[model samples]
Target: METTRRAGAEIALTEMPDDGARGDVDAATQIAAYRIVQEALSNAVRHAPRAPITVSVIADAADVTIRVRNAQATAVAGVPGGHGLRGMTERAHLLGGSLEAGADPDGGWTVTARLPRHPAPEASEGTL
Candidate 1:
């Protein structure tokens, strides 16, 4: 996947099971969920070179979740800010989803995102 992306410079790669939708997931939601994983992988590569990146997507009757983890990045010299993490969070929020990013106790950093099966409108229907 990385090699293919590198070849195109601007292309992004996504991997998912071929079993079709687990439940009620729509096309838009699935695309957004994959984008979250793609962005997370890009960030891990760009910010923590040489670190191993793991991406996983799981779907069930209720939601789709994406997880990306990488080893801790050693502090680099003279680097600027990183908006990849922030941008990912914003994307999740915009889709009425949630994102979690933090260091793992065993070592390394991890990001897990969950986007509900239903769209925002349907999800918010009964909220007070």
Candidate 2:
């Protein structure tokens, strides 16, 4: 949040679990979740400078879901196409999770990731 704010974008925490309320999510899952949001926020700021961004993290008994949505770009400065989205998706898939990113129908872009709270043991063993 501070990172985006520092980048001159208006950001908001639309939803989040209480501290320590994430339940029994593993360390790998936790780390993946953080990285997913990190990349999402970076993409938003880079592709839609000055746009309003809303971030939401909802943790349930089964999985932790993250959504980062930004309003239409006020100024797009990057050349586009980077490893950010791919890295984010790989992280999720490694943890038996999934990620999707695309432009919203109305306008703007949104990235969503769903990471299992208790992933299968073999899923992270490079079989993916």
Candidate 3:
């Protein structure tokens, strides 16, 4: 969680170049991404409290990849699960994206979301 916030703060401080870019995301989407990370971190802290959590965000010419991974179920008992995971999934879908949540091969939980750069056009020019 701390790592995630630090990363977001760092990115927020960095400035972008002046070169023309068509796929520049608005503040809303950026906020959404940040929120998603926050939610993921919170979940990890609550569910797998003692586990180490890693949140990564990578933006390239094509798309952005957000990943959150934490150590598997701890020895402790009584960890209820449902709402938070479902909410995260829905949020990703609302943005025309997808979310994946499952156990990692190396014994951990990994949640990843990929939001494409180009979404479907809302309407055609002459359709109306």
Top-TM-score candidate index: 2
Q: RMSD of model 3, in Å?
A: 6.7
Point out the higher-scoring one by lDDT: 1 or 2: 2
Candidate 2 lDDT over 1-128, as tens digits, reads 79678868788886666446556777778888888888899888777777889999888778889999999776565556789998998999988899999988878899999998878887655422
lDDT to native, each model:
0.67, 0.82, 0.61
Candidate 3 Cα deviation (angstroms), residue 103: 0.6
TM-score of 1: 0.71
Which scores higher on TM-score, 1 or 2? 2
Q: For model 3, where is the 10-residue window of minimal lDDT?
A: 119-128
* Clashing residue pairs for model 3: none
For candidate 3, write residues 6-117 as lDDT tens digits: 5442112222332245357544345556667777777766666667777677665545568888776563468666587787776666667678988878778878876544
What does candidate 1's lDDT look like per residue over 1-128, in tens digits? Answer: 46624633232223466347664676557666766777776666666666666677777666778888876666355666577778777666766888999888867778999877766775434221
* Candidate 3 local Cα displacement, residue 96, angstroms: 1.2
Model 1, runs deviating above 4 Å: 3-20, 73-75, 122-128
Model 2 residue 111 lDDT?
95
